[model samples]
Target: MRPKLLAAVLCLTLFGCASKQVVPTHNESRVQAEASLKAAESAGASRVPEAAQHMEFARQQIADAERLLVEGEQEAADMRFRQAEADADLALALARSIPLEREAQRATQQAEAARRSLQ
Candidate 1:
């Protein structure tokens, strides 16, 4: 019974160590970030000040992540990739919101004008 328990403990310890060796790569996050950046650009993020800033940040983060990956810093690279993805997504959302905001402003103006006329 003691030998069986020892063997089980050894196996668990080895398995845990092996699992730690499996470094996670963020390739999918990188891909998603690139896609989001492209979509933001397509949505005219470059024309929006805040959105452009976020887009630039995303690009920088991606570059940094790539460098980290080459340096074998898988955890740091993964974090940067995720940050890049978030920035790109935020940029896209901001770009999309600009047009909607303009539309809302126009509608508000129209409503005000109609109210004035009725009064």
Candidate 2:
């Protein structure tokens, strides 16, 4: 009886470890999206509109993922979550580039004016 009990305990422990290794895709996507959103927010405030939109979309995806996860459709949920994160990152990159682009344009204009004056 003691040996049987020990074997059961060992099996339970192994199962628990295995479960921990199986990270739900939705959770990973959610985390990545959140991180991207934070980066977008930090890059500049002018990107608020795009950032807000991305955040809203991400929230919706996360909600869907949660529902799917609850329904035991983990693989689908994970795919959606990854898509949400990609969308958020794209938005963030777009926002961060706006200011840089504007600066570049201004610099080019200034340089052109200087060249004209020199000529």
Pick by lDDT: which candidate is best?
1
Q: Which candidate number has the best TM-score?
A: 1
Relative to the true structure, candidate 2 reaches a TM of: 0.61
| Model 1 accuracy (lDDT, Cα) | 0.91
Stretches of candidate 2 exceeding 4 Å from the true structure: 1-25, 45-56
Candidate 1 residues 1-119, lDDT tens each? Answer: 99999999999999999888654458877787889889989999999998999999999999999999999988888999889889999999999898799999999999999999999
Which runs in model 1 stand beyond 4 Å of their true positions? 1-24
User: TM-score for every candidate vs. truth?
Assistant: 0.74, 0.61
Q: How many clashes does the backbone of model 1 have?
A: 0
What lDDT does each candidate get?
A: 0.91, 0.75
